[model samples]
Target: MYPLLEVHLDIIGENASKVLRLCEGKGIDVVGVTKGCSAFPEVAFVLLEAGIKILGDSRLDNIKKLRRAGVACPLMLLRIPMLSEIRELVELADMALVSEISVVKAINEEARRLGKFFKVILMIDMGDLREGIWPINLLSYLDSIRSLNYVELLGIGANFGCFGGVLPTPESVSMLINYASLAREYTLSDIPIVSVGGTVALQLLEEEK
Candidate 1:
C-alpha cells in the first residue's frame, strides 16, 4: 500500500466553492469535470457539494459510477459517444456532446426505445478538428437532426486546444456564440446550453477583456 493515493475531500470542496463563486459572479455555470481524477467518488461528491450544476466525464463508466453514488445533478457526457454504446449513453447521461449524424440517429433510436428524450449539444469544429462538425456544415446538419423527436437539441458548442492546440480567444468564442444564434434561428426556440468550452476555455473567463 506504499503507492496508495491520498485525497483531502474537505479541501477540494472549499477550493471548488471558491472557483464556482468566481465563475458564478461572471454569469458562468461550472461543470465539475471528473475525468482527470478518474471519477473518484469522494472527490466527485465534494464537487457536487460545492454546487456544480452538472458533472461531466469523458467516459460512460465514470458517469455511471457517479450516478450509482447518488450524485443528483444532471450528468453530461463530455466526449462524443460511439454508435455501439448509444443505449448506455441514453440510460446514463442526461446530456451529451455529439457531432456525427449517424451517432445522433442511433441516440434517437435508442432514446425512443428507452422511452426517454435525451438532450444534446451539437459540437462545431472551430479549427481544433477533434469532435465537431465543420462550421459550414453546421446548419445543414442541424436541419437533418431537427426532426429527431426523441432527442432534444439543447444547444451548440465547440472544442479547442485539445488536438490542434488552438487556443480559445474572444474572436473564436464569438464564432461559437454566432453558431448558437444560427441554431436558434433554425429551430425557432431558445437554445438552453450554449456550452462553448472545455478546460482551456477557462482562460477566456479569467481575462479582464
Candidate 2:
C-alpha cells in the first residue's frame, strides 16, 4: 500500500537520533526542515511524533495545514519573508530564516504589534549568491539587529541548493563556520547554528565507517 509519495520514517528516526546523539551536550537542536515533503502533513506528523522539536517549511499553506492538524511543535519558515504576508507568516511561524535587514525589521514590527518576540536565524550568504547578504554586508546587518529589541536573533544558517548553486561548496561552508566562530569569539553569538541542510551533502555526512 505504498502511497504515490512517501517519507521514510525509519530513516528519519535514525537521522534524528544521530543528530541528537552527535550533538549531545553540544548545545544544538535539530529541526526537521519538512518542506521537502510538507505538502503532505503526514510526513511532518511522523517527524513530530518522533520528537523533532521544530518543524520547518517554506510554504504558508503547509504551515497552516500542520497547525490545523494539531501539531504542537514550533514552526519555522524557510522562505524569504514577504511584507504583504507578514501578518500571516508571523501568525503561523514561530521562527523564520531571514537574510535581509528590512525583513528582519518587518518581522519585528509585526511581532511588536502582536506583542510577541519572534525567533530568527540570520542567514549568511557564504557564497550563496541567493538570498543572504554578502560577507561584507553581513556585519551591518548584525550591528542593526543589536539595536533592535523585538525579535530574537536565534543564530545563523545558510542554504546550499538555491540560486546559482553557490551554497554547496566546502569552501563556502568552511568560510561560514569560520566566520561564525569568529563572531562567537567576539561575543556576537556564543553558539551559532551553522546548519548544513540538503540532500546533496547527506552522503558525505552519513556514517561511512
lDDT of 1 by residue, 111-170 (tens): 999999998889998888887988889878888788888988888888888889888888
lDDT, model 1: 0.86
**Clash count for each candidate, listed in order shown:** 0, 0
Model 2 score (lDDT): 0.73
TM-score of 1: 0.95
